[model samples]
Target chain A: MIPNIFRLTLPILFGYVPLGTAFGVLFATQLDYAWWLAPLMGVVIYAGAGQILAVSLLAAHAGLLEVFVAMLVLNARHVFYGLSLLRQFRGAGLKKLYLIFGLTDETYSLLTTRPRGGSPQEEHRTDVAITFANQIYWVLGCAIGALLGRSVEFDSTGIEFALVALFIVLAIEQFKALGSQKPLWMGAAAAGLALALLPPAQQLIGAIVMVTAALLLQYNLQRNTTLTREANHD
Target chain B: MTEPMYLAAFIAVTALATFLTRVTPFVFLSRHSEHPLLQHLGQFLPAAVMTLLVIIFLHRSAHWSAPTFGLDAIGPALVVVVLHLWKRHALLSIAAGTVCYMLVQQF
Candidate 1:
């Protein structure tokens, strides 16, 4: 079980290690009382971007309402992820709950790319292992970064782009696999429109709302048209 | 009150939101779902969500508010896109892209 978990999550470490390290370094250097906040955020929040924003807001002494709203908005996309995974979550008992809690963007993508292909029991083990391994890498990365921040002084600038790079690569993989650019274009268009119309802070939520609405509307329209055509044929 | 106390409250609020976001779909689907709609969203939404992320990154890296043709963003993103296309290895592709971005930052 351990070996299988390691092998499955090994690829994720490449991205998580560096990305988590970037967050750690920033948390350690930029924020006050850097050490505890670094790994503590790693354990609790566990969402990468939300953690980064936490550091920024806490350092600035942002209001609690402000912090809560920002974190909620930043991580809102996790809801969309749950929609796709609901079927898989059924009949897994309590572990389905853990699976939901652990559904980070990378974890979701990795699982989708290669499902836990085994018996129901084996699948449960594989998922638990995968989630554990990924979080372990993340927590370790934050710990290392906090320690290094206390001890060393060096340039680790531009490392956060590791995340941007990761997302780009993942998006391209999904694009290639789907072999249809409709969703891609629709989503990109929604994001672009949101960026133009909404404020910077609200752009993410706006983009998500826009994309989901557009996609569902198009889906319903297509289905209705197909139904009418079938009725005509009949 | 101390910073840790404040931080704990902050973490709790954030964690609640995060957990709510994660569990809502399960709750929603269990309550009610149109088979075609839910299934279509499950199949197609990942691609769309990923694309949304890709554009978000593009906006961040490029710094859209500046109103200039920014190579800072484009050059490295292109490197990632091209490298992924060529190698088909996730680690190699990501490494090449990060190194490219880091190097570009030097200039």
Candidate 2:
């Protein structure tokens, strides 16, 4: 059972291992501990980009409230991930709580877009295993990298481009899955507008709220127009 | 002296906040709401957020002074975009892009 989980998490293993190593190295060099907090954050925080940002924040002696708010902004997308998976998680029992807690971006994408199969019981089991395996891979990476902290001689710069590519691929796939270009383009427009107008720190939430408001307006307008036309027709 | 304490507090608070982001929707929305608005946000928000995220990376990855758009990062970024569009493989595209960027940086 565990082996199956490892096999399924193979792709994430590639991404997580290296990325977690980067996080670990950064944490060790930049933060309070050279070895400890890597795995601790991996287990407790488990946020990828947010954790990276946290290292920078903590290194800068950011206040606790600042750290909290910055992380909240960095992780805002997670709320949407949880919302999407709400139905799938219904009555998932104690495991359901785990699922909610484990809803990282990569995990959410894989589970939500995964091809469904087997009985519900089998599926849930697979999910639990996958989550466990992915996080374990991450923790392992952090531990290994933290132990090897700051001793390596190599250029690891721009390695984070992989994450950029991952998000692009994910966005494209999500766009394809939705099969509606309207929301996506509008989203792009909203983001561009926000980026132009707001501070970098403020842009994400601004874009999200703008997109949400635009979508709501679009939906309401379409509904009202359809209703009006139907009344006239009748 | 208090640095360690502050660090611990920072980690705990951030962890709690992160946990809430993941759990609150499930806890609260699952109880009182099945509204289409929530449903729509779930469906469409990811693509939008991800698009913005990519934009953020693109903006951060380079500091272009000339509008000519230097080949510094764009060449590899374009590689990623094209590879993803053509091959539709996430890991493959990411690997290719990272390799391309690393190679470019060597120059």
Candidate 3:
């Protein structure tokens, strides 16, 4: 079971380690905290981008309230992740708490596309195992990078592009799974519009709101079209 | 060195805020799991949300003011999409794409 879980989350392992290392190096080089604090943030916060943002915010001496609000808004896309997993996690038991806590973009992508375990009990174990393995890779990377950052000179520029690739791969996988261009087009349009109109700070939430409204409007359109056809048949 | 108390408070506040973002939908929408609207979103939101994320990242990666004008980002992004479509391996595509980005930016 443990080996299988590792295999399932191997891609995430590849992505998280380097990304976490980048975060750690950045934190260690820029901030005033000890190197160990990087991995500690990896364990407690567990958000790649959010952790990076926090480091920058702290370095800039942003207030606690500012950090709180910024982190919340930065991670707001997570709300949609939980909505999609509502059915899969219905009876996930106490582990559901941890599952929700660790529902990062990569984890959510992996969980949604994989086949379920044989039974509900096995499924919960698999979920927990996958989540735990990913975090271990993350924390391990943070430790390595932070230690290296303190002692060595390393250039990690362009390394974080791995995260961009991860998102692209997952988006392609989702497209193939759905076999529909509607979501892709709708999402791109919403993102484009939000990028055009909203500030960087608000773009993510703006796009999410726009996409949800568009999806609901699409649902109503389909329902109306079906009813019109039925009435004509009658 | 930053004070221990300040660091702890910073971590706690940021972690709590991030967890709240993740757990909000589950807390509010778990009971509506069977509703048609929620069901519709479950079926469709993943793809849409994933697309949005990709776009956001691409925007971030692009060099809006540089002379190359985002060619670095677009070139490697194309590599990623094409490689994944061909091999269907997530790690391979990501590794290749990152390498491509790193190499492309060197010039």
Candidate 4:
């Protein structure tokens, strides 16, 4: 289990460190923000999306209330991920709090695939271990980034697009893992439709609505397909 | 912006909010069996979340009316989609996209 965790997390660790470094450099040089604050943001926020939003809001001189509201809405999905994994960490004893706190998107993705038939205690340990590993990687990345920013002639121009590419890859991976084209198509359609209908400020809300509607459509389609299969069997 | 004060406040507030979001569900769920509505919602949340993320990516910039089909932007976007569809790796997609973006911008 330990070896598996290490292998799984190593890629993420490598990828995030440089990206974190880019972020640190951007904050320190471009924004003229403090150097140490970059890693501090990483450890505290632990969210790629939220960190970007925070930066944009700060740049725009957005009020604190606006930043808070935006962060809350963007991160509301984590609530669902946490709820789904509740049973896994229910009896985690002292580690439960840390486990929950470390439940980033990457960590959650890694934890969802625990091999079956372990003792509940073992399962809990594995979940917590995976979560810990991912957070440690993020922290390490952020720290390296902060330190690297001091001497290196760091350039952040155009690096922001990396996040977009990362998400596209993640979306494709989710599609492959779920073995369904319906969800992907639904997501793309919803995004396109929302862009057409909503104004800029309300675009996020429109996308959320479309996504929820797409999920419902997928659920119904899936349910009907299953019922038909069962009927055929009967 | 005074660096220390802004940084300190940003860290404190963000940390508090993030911690709350992460911890709330664990506390609620550990106390009870999963409710049916929660389960149903959970099942759909990932798709919804991913969809929203993609929308943000596509329309983040304010210049929606004048889409810049510049190679610096569109080239990388296309490369990312292709590499992701083919390689299915996050790191590769990012590296290829970045390189594509840089190369296009240089020319």
Candidate 5:
């Protein structure tokens, strides 16, 4: 039955392995570190964009604080991923730690949207299976690409665009599930504002902050309106 | 680059910072799972966050100053969206979009 998880994770396997390979190739070619470090970071860091970003940062000889802050901002969206899964992950047990650790953008999207199993135990098992499967694909891909890095001579210029494609697909799925475009519009406005105002490194965090504030304000107004409507009915 | 020995420390710090971001909400909000605010955020946050991520990624990947003026990215992005809306297949959309992007970028 373990292989059953592969069926569920096939798309992610396709996504992570190639993306991880891209990271591995970049790491091998860009940094002074050994090729092995590419897969090592894949195992420990487990974030595609963050790992890719680290390649440039390390190449530039960035300090620990700089790497830390950059990674935190780049991954700030993960905070909300955990928030969305709090109830679903309640009985995940020891795997819960791994779950949180492995909550990349793709994993979180899959977890939120994948159909639940028959029971909580079954669901937790599926969750762990999916999470573990994705990481293995990523690490394996990283190892392959690192080994091939020096020998390969092809251009990898636009391969990272796979990530953009992945996110676009996920965005569409989220829209279908949520059945509203307000969030999309809000996101576009906030991201546009951030792009115009912030530097490249700061844009993600700026967009997150603006979107979060707008969401909170919208949520409060919605609650108040609902309360008022209930009172009028009474 | 700096000494190779410092690389380990850098990796350690990066992993910790990323973990903290993913874990912070669960650490602070697990006990408040049933709170109305948490519930509301849970209901809508995924959609909003996903949208934000998509926009940010598209913006980051584009080159607004280039002669192509971001078409390399925007064209493939549109293909991803349109193809997914039509086919509703994730892998197909991503593969097609990536190929489209590579073509535009290289040629």
Candidate 6:
């Protein structure tokens, strides 16, 4: 289990380190914020989307309420993640706090696939391990970024695309595994439609609504398919 | 752009709002069994979340106003996507994307 945890987490650590470092460097150089602030925000916020939004909001002179609303819309999916893991995380003890706090997207992807006994204790251990691994990677990345930002003179422009690519890869992997074109089509339609409907600031909200609607549509379709299969079997 | 005090206030309030959004669901929901509806929503949440994220990236530059339909971004994004699909590697995709972005930014 120890080895498995390390193996599972190594990829994420490597990816996050440079990404976090770039962010730290960017914040330090561009925003002139303190170095520690980068890592602190990384750990606490942990949402790349939110961090980027924060920077843009800060740049645009957006109000506090606007920033808050934007973040809520961007991160609203986390509520569903927390809900799904409730049963799996029921008895986590002190780790319960960490499990909840550290339920980032990467951690969720890792934990959902981790092999464990059906027992609550085993599930809790897996959750804690996953959470610990994810946070450690993020912090290490931030530290590297802070140090590099101060010392290194190399151009770090365009480094942000690493994260964008990472998410795209993950999404593609999920799509392949699920073998469902419906969800993909739905997402594409919803996003395109939302882009048309919402202004720049409210795009996030429109996207959320569209995605939710797509999910509902997919759910209904899946239900109908299952019923037909059962009827055929009967 | 503003005074130090305002910056400090901004960070503090932002921190509070961010923390609550992340921490609240875990604290309140972790103790309960997964509800049927929650489970239903959970299965699709990742896809939904990923879709939102992708849209944000594609639209990050505001619109496809560029002459080539964001070819600067789309070209590199396509490269990154292909590399990742083939290699199933995150680091490689990132490296490819960064190199491509830098190369494109110059021309």
Ranked by TM-score, the better of candidates 4 and 5 is: 5
Ordered by lDDT, highest first, the candidates read 3, 5, 2, 1, 6, 4
Q: Which ten contiguous residues of candidate 3 chain B have the minimum total lDDT?
A: B1-10
Q: Model 3, residue B43: displacement in angstroms?
A: 1.0
- Lowest-sum lDDT 10-residue window in model 1 chain A: A150-159
| Regions of candidate 5 where Cα sits further than 4 Å from its true position | A1-11, A56-70, A154-157, B1-5, B65-67
Better of 1 and 5 by TM-score: 5
Q: Which ten residues in a row are the worst by lDDT in model 3 chain A?
A: A150-159
Best by lDDT, which number? 3
> How would you order the candidates by DockQ, starting with the best?
3, 5, 1, 2, 6, 4
lDDT score at residue A21, model 6, on the 0-100 scale: 76
Residue by residue across A75-181, what tens digits does model 6's lDDT show?
76566566556666665678877776777767766665444566788778867876887787787777677767767666655655655665566667667766765
lDDT per residue for candidate 2 within A1-234, as digits (tens), equals: 776666556667766887898888888877657487788889998888878888888878887788888788777867667766776677678898778778887787667666666777778878888888889888888887788788857766666566666767777887888887776688778878987999977776687778778877877887789899999999
Alpha carbon lDDT at B94, candidate 5: 87
Across B1-107, the per-residue lDDT of candidate 4 in tens digits comes to 66566656766666667767778777667666466545554554554456456556645621334345444465677788898888766567777886766555444
Model 1 DockQ, alpha carbons vs. true complex:
0.61
TM-score of each: 0.85, 0.84, 0.90, 0.67, 0.87, 0.71
User: Residue A122 CA error for candidate 5 (Å)?
Assistant: 2.0
Candidate 5: TM-score, chain B only: 0.82
Per-residue lDDT, model 5, residue A175, is 83
- Quote the chain B TM-score of every prediction: 0.78, 0.75, 0.84, 0.59, 0.82, 0.74
Write the residue-wise lDDT of candidate 4 on A102-124 in tens digits.
87766765565334478888877
- Worst lDDT run of 10 residues, candidate 6 chain A, spans A109-118
**Off by more than 4 A, model 4:** A1-3, A30-34, A52-70, A112-120, A144-173, A197-206, A213-234, B1-10, B27-33, B51-107
Indicate which candidate wins on TM-score: 3
Model 4 clashing-pair count = 0
